[model samples]
Target: MKQLNILLTAVALLLFTQEQAHSQIKLSDIFKKVTDRQSSSATSAGAPTTSEIGLGIKEALQLGVSAGADRLSVKDGFLGNLAVKILMPPEAQKVEKTLRGIGLNSLCDNVITSLNRAAEDAAKEAKPIFISAIKQMTLTDATNILLGKTDAATEYFKRVTSAQLTEKFSPIVTTSLNKVNATKYYSDLTTQYNRLPLVKPVNTNLTAYVTQKAIDGLFIEVAKEELKIRGNINARSSTLLQKVFGYADKKKS
Candidate 1:
């Protein structure tokens, strides 16, 4: 019995030593294991860092333009929509106000409506040129634009394509103005407005003004679409957009 008790005591002592060793594992050692695991995971994941912000910005800008352009190309997208109606600039505004102030409101209304209609007609011709611009947009260009301000992409577009678009749009607007009888309406309106006593003689090139206004309106619409995608969760139409923009959304949150 004494021998058996001694053997039992030895076995119990061995188990207690093992249990104590297991429980006595150093907190610092445990913490080191966790740190090593985290470091290995971080190295393996290889997520894009701060340097790639330019790239992300570019992707977002391109996506915005794509979405905006797509929306603008549709029927009633630019033409029938009053919200984005193409109108005159500061120069033409003076002419319009004078005309309306002189009780020639009907003539003034007609001329303004005709100008916008010409723009609407001319805008249809812009698809090919705008598409070419989009196609020519390089990864670097997109990255730079993405890194730019809210209107940076727009400014880039204006800098790069404005001359070409203006050149192309002028003839189209002129042709559309003629097609829609804009020249005659504006001529009559101008003659009536200029004859008003105490008013300066007003001479406006309807074609040039309409063309520029139309292009500006198109850009405005494009920007709206871009803003929607950047802000509204539901506006993200594709998986690529969702995946890429998901990061942007997280940052905002």
Candidate 2:
């Protein structure tokens, strides 16, 4: 299945490359014809030669990081946003359902809600870390990314910032969870659930679980914002941003 998926992706990529090359050829030919006609008529009467407007690796990625982090730091950012809401994973969901089925629904619900709240609160601190990464980008970074595949910019940001962001965000998530009483809530729930009839009780780690979930949610939101800024003309907030992101926009369309 994985190999088949890879094959399909390669085919799609080839088609996209053909289309892009076709467009570039068509546009270049048109421009050359126009330039020749203008030169024959009058050199000064022609439109000025247009420079390439594509963003290099450094600029596109820096813009992506900035735009993504900006969106996350705003009011209702990750907390109130449904698209980035942190929810229980499959394993944890099973545990919750099992506890609920055995008459421990209240505890399960408390733990679930509190875990999400902690993640939402923790999401606020993501901007600084992302900004720091963006600041470190250089012209070489831009060139390398321009030659890479789709989502290359995002992948680079993940490699550089994921660990640092996790470290910075973990403590905040932990504090938020504790502040919301998620630890005690899960503890009491587990106690009651464990006491249930004929069940093998298992201890769960709430802090570690919430920490992972929170970070996952943060990255998901950041990626969405990055994709938008890279693809959508209306999302560019500055002159440099528009120029930089225009490259990605053209690459997509």
Candidate 3:
């Protein structure tokens, strides 16, 4: 089964060698495998190849990361996109309600805005981490991911990279939160809420909140980009992408 997968991948990869700019492949198609066997490459399997089949996986990751990062890490990246918008953390919901009920609507709004801005600021630092994680992919990882369900890569990243990303992002989120006065806004809101009659004091970690939110939003975009490649032919963006993903599509049908 593993040899067969490699043979099929290698044969499809030939389309990329004909000056057709086959380097641009989709991550979903690259990971469109359904086995949990040992990882094998086209060359090792003697199927014929210019590069390791894992290269295709890596390339797809690059595209997904670049697109995901580009779509985010910008003005209103998290704030404007409802799909991935950063909002008041669950623990702070009552604080928001209390603040809003107390007629501090502007304060509530500012705090939410600042949280999102911090997310955007911290998002800029994600590409290098994402790329590093991509480099860690093994042939087994590639094959398993390709054969797994859609968003499997996203789940893999979330599983493996989430902790590292949070560690890396926390300080950046802290800095960004401070830069955006999210800390001050949150502090002011919390301080005021705590003083209210019988209102519980809140001491949430603002940086941790934004870090996780940023990571979540980042993956949402990555999944979207992956789905685009999987389902939309126009979204494939390159001959290699078309050929590799077209194979997946044909097999599925």
Which candidate wins on lDDT? 3
Give candidate 1's total backbone clashes: 2
Report the lDDT tens digits of candidate 1 across residue range 1-253.
Answer: 9999999999999999998887677766888899999999957745344445444544555566665555554554555677676555566678777767868787766766677777766666666666667667776666555444556667777777788879988998888788777888888877776786888777877777887887887788667766676678787666555644565555446
2 versus 3: better TM-score goes to: 3
Which residue pairs collide in model 2, if any? Answer: 57-142, 58-142
Better of 1 and 3 by TM-score: 3
Among residues 3 or more apart in sequence or in different chains, the pairs in candidate 3 whose N, CA or C atoms overlap within 3 Å are: 31-146, 32-146, 33-146, 33-147, 34-147
lDDT of 2 by residue, 9-95 (tens): 999999999999999999999999999988887644332112222233334455665565555555545556677655554545666
Model 3 segments more than 4 A misplaced: 1-53
- lDDT against the true structure, each candidate: 0.69, 0.66, 0.81
Worst 10 residues of 2 by lDDT: 45-54
Q: Which digits, one per residue and each the tens of the lDDT, describe model 3 over residues 1-253?
A: 9999999999887866743554444444456552222255432443212234466656777899898988789999899999999889898998998788879999989999999998998888889988998898888787666556788788888888888888888988898898989999999988898988987788998887889899999999989877776778887676565555665565567
Q: What is the lDDT of residue 50 in candidate 3?
A: 26
